[model samples]
Target chain A: MDVRQLSEAVTEKTKVDTTARDVEKIISGLASSSHFWEIVCATQKPFSVVAEIIGALKEKGLVRVDQEGEITLTPQGQEFLKENFIAPRRDYTCPACEGRGIGLEKIKEWMQKFDELTVDRPKAIIDYDQGYITTASVMARVALMTERGDLEGKKLLVLGDDDLLSLAAGLTGMPKEIVVLEIDERLVNYINEKASMLSVPVKALKYDFRDKLPEQYVGYFDTFNTDPPETIEALEVCMTRGLSSLSGEGCAGYFGLTRTEASLKKWSQFQKMLLSKFKVAITDIIDNFNHYVNWDYLLGSIRDDYSFVQVKPKLNWYRSSMYRIETVSGFEKIENRPMPCELYVDEEALIYKPDKSR
Target chain B: MDVRQLSEAVTEKTKVDTTARDVEKIISGLASSSHFWEIVCATQKPFSVVAEIIGALKEKGLVRVDQEGEITLTPQGQEFLKENFIAPRRDYTCPACEGRGIGLEKIKEWMQKFDELTVDRPKAIIDYDQGYITTASVMARVALMTERGDLEGKKLLVLGDDDLLSLAAGLTGMPKEIVVLEIDERLVNYINEKASMLSVPVKALKYDFRDKLPEQYVGYFDTFNTDPPETIEALEVCMTRGLSSLSGEGCAGYFGLTRTEASLKKWSQFQKMLLSKFKVAITDIIDNFNHYVNWDYLLGSIRDDYSFVQVKPKLNWYRSSMYRIETVSGFEKIENRPMPCELYVDEEALIYKPDKSR
Candidate 1:
């Protein structure tokens, strides 16, 4: 079975509505002889496409592939594809594009461009694992916004394409416009495509915030949310610039990093700087694994130059689990709720909607 | 009221036994009129000595000074001291000896000698502020130790001359012997003097721990307490080598730096390395300031670092104030126990007797 066959199978089974070209590019990428299993493991693609792709490869008689086994492209199969197949052209896959929407690729490209301008040049050191596990942490911010009635008809600008922010936008479902400023174009496109597919009104903007922001967007957003940049200086600048762009009595929700002494110090400094401009009403340090995941990989990806010494007395799991948040001016904390146990539940369980009437 | 009269007054008032030489050195240092106030501010000396020394200068008509003031030495007094007194005795008066104890000059020389030996060369980065706070933290540690029944007649070996460790030795009053290892011979001598003054049973040992420890003391200590060097590699080597020298089931209490992401990674690696030998237990990350200072400093000195960040949300004070402690391996956690509060009072309130009879 080939990409065409896999696409046909997915369309029949899931009604996902994807073109044969799109399926071909995705499958061919997966079927590349060099470490195909790793690609399958890393990509968060739906299960149907994954199964169909694998099934097609096995059925072709060109390769003996196991359905319940790890997928690897055989040498003969690799040669057959190279000789006979015309490689499907790769198009920017917009996550916000639902069912072949117009301008999906354009939006994806725009977000990609923005991400190139923003995240690619300088990597933000983030604990994606912690962010993955601490899913309930975002609820604190959302609750605050809801209590203040800021979510209704409010233009919320989410800076960074991390899953937390995307999930947050999907859950809250109140912001008049949820604009995502992302550094990875592919991620922006992916999120856009997902949002479009799900009928979530989230827009992806690809822009490097390090440089001066576009004048057209000045004062365009009312509320801002950011996962702080890695460097202390960059974080400070991001906070200042992000907050400065807010209109009216707007506030920014900072997913401030608070793990290491250095990060804590930076957060403290950022807080101090922000306190001068806005009034902080609520601050919490909580532990909720649903909000974050892949902590080991996140910490490893960020290059830390400072040398630290470790003293192993005993493992105190409770103390290490907590994280903190501070609510800025014009926002009031609604409640202190415990983290939900099932974080990776489907979108239906997690999507939050404020009052329908703006 | 010249230097002689002022010396006599101090001796009469405090009944602190001080030789004429000690009085003269202190008085002259104060009356030198060259950045005298800065020196007085920097040195951790008694206010009485500073007052008397200034009083003597005024009485002698050596200089006109302000009593209701931060002491300032006049130019006339400075010139007289430089030409007639300071130059001749500059070499004799040790710079390290601040007259209160062996001065900075002696300590510097001792540090130089310590450097010559290829041992304990990479000293731990001791944050003076954190160390100041640790004096109370150690008290809290003692409270925990008492609760654990780990503090009876056990031989407690203190590897560094930390003020907290010294105070812990004094307050517990149950250790078989408290041996303090200090690389600086002068500091060891000074600490010995302080211990004697306090009537604390502390034995000061001048030794570089990077090299092999003296065989006479090998495996002699039951409980090892030290703020170990901070680097993971150094800490691992130190803990392995130092803890190995302990008797069976003997525990070592190490107070060093807190964990960061890098430190956590390093610690995880260190734990893996030590898993074959030691069964680790007990870890606490205490963040409350009240857990480190009495009401005085908690309200005063610590007010400098506390402030709000308006961007991130704060935890609701009532709902979020409670913190949890869980059992990791061998020990059960005390319930409803808040983070250590009343650092000075509650920590010392518990009486500890180590199970030496076992």
Candidate 2:
């Protein structure tokens, strides 16, 4: 055979004219709403391309169009969706969002294993004033990290796991040790109770970031995670404590930081502290991975200052950036960086004012 | 009717018995590639729940089970999938990631209108050694913000748009004025040429961050966007220049910061510089918004030192954090900030050591 003919034959065989499958994919993905065909023609693909696709799908018996120009999927089209798209809901099903819009469903069926955790609301004693950790975010953290193999059989320390993420880690049936340091006795007891029930090899201690980290924990943990206060003083102290808890060389730490409280200035400071001082580099950060659902009370507290209080956040608008930090050159010794005695920063010191009224 | 009997009747009437729908939702969402019954048994509802659900689905003729205990969805089941899931792809589809796993599709169908801009590859003559901006990300940024009315009829300035994000903004046909100040002459010409071709009403000038701001450009734009080199000097210069380009009061800036290159310490310094001097507050940051497909050349440069280089990435793994910075108190004057004369930071200064062996 001639070279061109041989090439054409090879291409024909390999390609198998995927136009059929491509049409199916397009139809199945787009068969959601009535106006989808018009949408496809008007915005994404050109009218001619879309018309061609519609014609192909009609020939394939995957769709039907009415006189009103509305598009509806045929049984074959619906079958394609069933074959390819539908995913299950895990134990972390959202009663609030119902896995809508947030795309939590994509991760939840897999995140179910992290649901061995006990649920608790933030108490007044500890300052959840900064952030609230939802069960969904905990499951997501474990799932995403586990996918990266960052959380398997490692000794992890939770600097302030008010969220009870240790339970989630233990639920992974992975982490060798799950240690939590918390000032809130309620969280400690609740965590311990669930940990024991789940056989989660976890222990909780009533401690605070303000105090010196327990010596035995120094360089003992393979990883650490925290959602520290937003102020420089509190963040430095909390971060230093978290870093100090880490073992030397390639240890990791997960930090849940928010843009709402930490401005570019504060974010830069955090990067400097973790990257330069602790010798930890941020390799990955999933944007707004940690969504806070139970922050209504805190918002109520500042309601007078912020206008959004009247509307109240029905959706999970508050989210934190999750940083996966890895130790670069062992661990850096964080010395007397100011650890503010105050557990929470007052309104005056807040760099980020949430409401435009201010 | 007696009170108890009446209550029972009312309960029966209102109960409407949605257990069937619940069972279907569970089965449909969880059915993909999994012995879903096993998953249900292992992590979710009890055995009775599973048995009842399976019986309901089988009776409805939506699913079938074989003697081998394997389960498959029928045409009816596919219809359920069509009713519940499946998403359309957009021009913002990632060459590296294809908008999969990143959960971008949830927003991309609506994101296509933002793709009024065309696709452009990263140029090497300029400094993509810092960050690669995917057309997917540009569309995502524009789409997401445009949905929120951020880019509509606003004057925008690009500090170092090697990514040609300005083109995407111009394509929006929303921004009143799109101005670009870039150090790379090639980018300036390329962007200008495309701006004219696309009729995007964008103008580009060859400019460096270290140079003093020209008179008209100062506080002129409603917003600014930049993916600065990750050095305290380069970043500060690039940032200050961007801020200077914006007009006072309600003006904003979009920052493309990466968790990979800048360490915590470096990040802290940046935050302090922007937050303290500029009075900018970060309102939102979407992670993994910017996926880089053009880092192969940079990765190739240090191929010998990095072990992963041997595998050669077919999937785009590089991503950046998109920061939505709202200027508070309408742009504070930055003073005593160090602006490095050099636009690019050399490899030695990079905190992120991609090649571990080095």
Candidate 3:
């Protein structure tokens, strides 16, 4: 079959946003690396969609998968790619900043100090779906905030402190005050101890976002940051809480969303919520900005049962793009209500399970 | 007045999102440069908002403006900045890529050819609000497309050819087809002449976006690109044209939006339309990605009447962030109808004048 016909068949079967060119690009990614995770990263597509694309290619006799599940393009696939002018995929993203367009040179000292302070921090707890980003990433976030004039005397809030972004912002000595609302008491106590010892203007309070925000925090903060669960319900609750805390009109919020757990449909829904329900303008969205270190529970989870992801990965495979949204005039204050237990698990979610205790 | 009180006052008076910290940031921006354009670029806020902030600062005795319009911090302003730990604003964005996280190294040869071909391109006419970006910016755009695998053997569409993006993409010897729908007859003839001479798979056709798209072109493209006039109505028309040309789900489109021309309220409204009406996912938004050469008519326009722009700018200051959106399941294509003359003129728009001929 021709390339366009094959791509059309794949799109029909998989029901994904796929083009003949993307089909060629996916095949080109497999030329150098048969590893599934590497191909996914190269394609910048969801693993589930990539898996289906490969299945269609195999059925078309353009690619083959051995018993070990290693993917390789067949002679027909190679010739098709050549005739279609599909060259080897090249990543030309800037080396210094990883395509975030911002680097960490200005905050080296603060980043070093943040690393030292959080070296003994708690590990990722699978129950909370908590996996923290690298300290350098946190520092990069601070540097961006500084560059955007969001730091230095701004009231900063962190809805979840597993990443310890509050401490990082506090270390810059830029913000007027940093408040962290973390559900994990362990993280809260840890942050409090460190803030007290270091004497930074930071405070940690234990509060689940599923509950109503305290009266004092309403319309009080200039910025809010969160890395919430990717489920629709979690995003609604978390984003609503972030909006409620803003003083109004130009208050900014930062959050992270991943393609691994959330489909593009969910992303569309989330953005719709932010724009219509919250009346906020999305200012920036840097792709793959937050690189997450693999947590301990990844290998033991349902992700292993997927048809792709053939081998155990030694690399940090999970990452989420960073998003910054700002209020223009005002935003709706979505009243907080107790969330159901199934707010974390959805059809596309891999590692999340219901936390019944809440 | 204290910093918080000053910020609150500024926010109240201007009805823009200003924080106590942002007031200090404005002051810090002024510490080194008194030029209005320089400060606006440094602070990355709207020009109108910055002008109001400076007015508030002057009222509060933190700054003074000379007859020539140079601004300087008062001793109390300096002291307030010092006491609040506000330092001189430093931009740590990566120097090489200018914080776009992508560079033009990969397409240097193609960029050179593009420049050589378009050396005698048409001058930007002010009535259509036409101003083209630098050649380097266009090359950087092509590189970003290459890195995203959107260029190779794809059916590409350019909604407007004033930027000559179709020619740039064509010179790469990629893309299965390139189509340009341009309102400017000069740009259309120029692009078609060059494409025929170069033997590139590109066609430029004169078409107004307010009219219905040609039936033959519907659902015929894999990707579309445009830099539309930043009015709410123009965005709707241009974006709908781009969407209607896409084959189906997984197609991508590129556009530009500038804060200088569109307010955050307009941005929020536009994003709402993109998400709800079109069902597209915003993948990336690189701030200040497209730097425009100062159009000849800028100094002769209403923008010169602003109080804060104390002196004429010698540097190129107009810029717009690049936006990339992709369809997921499917998108809605709004039918085109004849639009009004005021479609391009809005309260926030600075350079646009109605083209009566259309």
Model number with the top lDDT: 3
Badly placed stretches (over 4 Å) of model 3 are A1-25, A55-61, A65-70, A80-88, A303-308, A332-337, A351-358, B1-28, B52-61, B66-69, B79-88, B303-310, B332-337, B341-343, B351-358
On residues A43-161, what C-alpha lDDT tens digit does candidate 1 reach at each position? 21232344445456556654454433344457666675566452312212112321111122323433443333323222223322223322233343444344333354557777765
Task: List, in the given order, the native-contact fraction of each candidate.
Answer: 0.00, 0.02, 0.73
Q: Candidate 2's residue-wise lDDT over A1-358, tens digit each?
A: 1222422342243221112222332453355444532233212222223334555455567667665455667878678555643211111122333322134555555356554344344453323454556766777677555533346656788887766688877876767788999878777888888888888789999986877887788878767888887666777788788778776545667888765444334554555454445555454554556776545354344424212123334356556667776654324555533354665653322322334244
Which number leads on TM-score?
A: 3
**DockQ list for all candidates:** 0.00, 0.02, 0.55
Model 3 docking grade = medium
Q: Candidate 2 at residue A200, lDDT?
A: 78
Considering every candidate listed, which one attains the maximal DockQ? 3
Proportion of true inter-chain contacts also present in candidate 1: 0.00
Clash count in backbone of candidate 2: 25
Model 3 over residues A1-358: C-alpha lDDT tens digits? 6667766676575444455555666887987678777787777665656776787778888888876667888999888778867767767777777777776565678878988998899999877778998766888888887776677778988998899998898877789999999999999999999999889999999998888888899889889999988778788888888888988766789998887667677788888877778778999988878878778776565444445554665566678888999887646565655554445555555334423233
lDDT of 3 by residue, B1-358 (tens): 6766766675565445455546666777988788877787776665666777788778878888887777888998788777876677868787767777776565568778988999999999965678998887787888787777777778998987788899999988888899999888999999999999999999999988887788888888888999988777789888888888888776788988887767677788899987888878898888888878877765565444445564666556778898999887646555655555445455455334323233
User: How good is the docking of model 2, as DockQ?
Assistant: 0.02
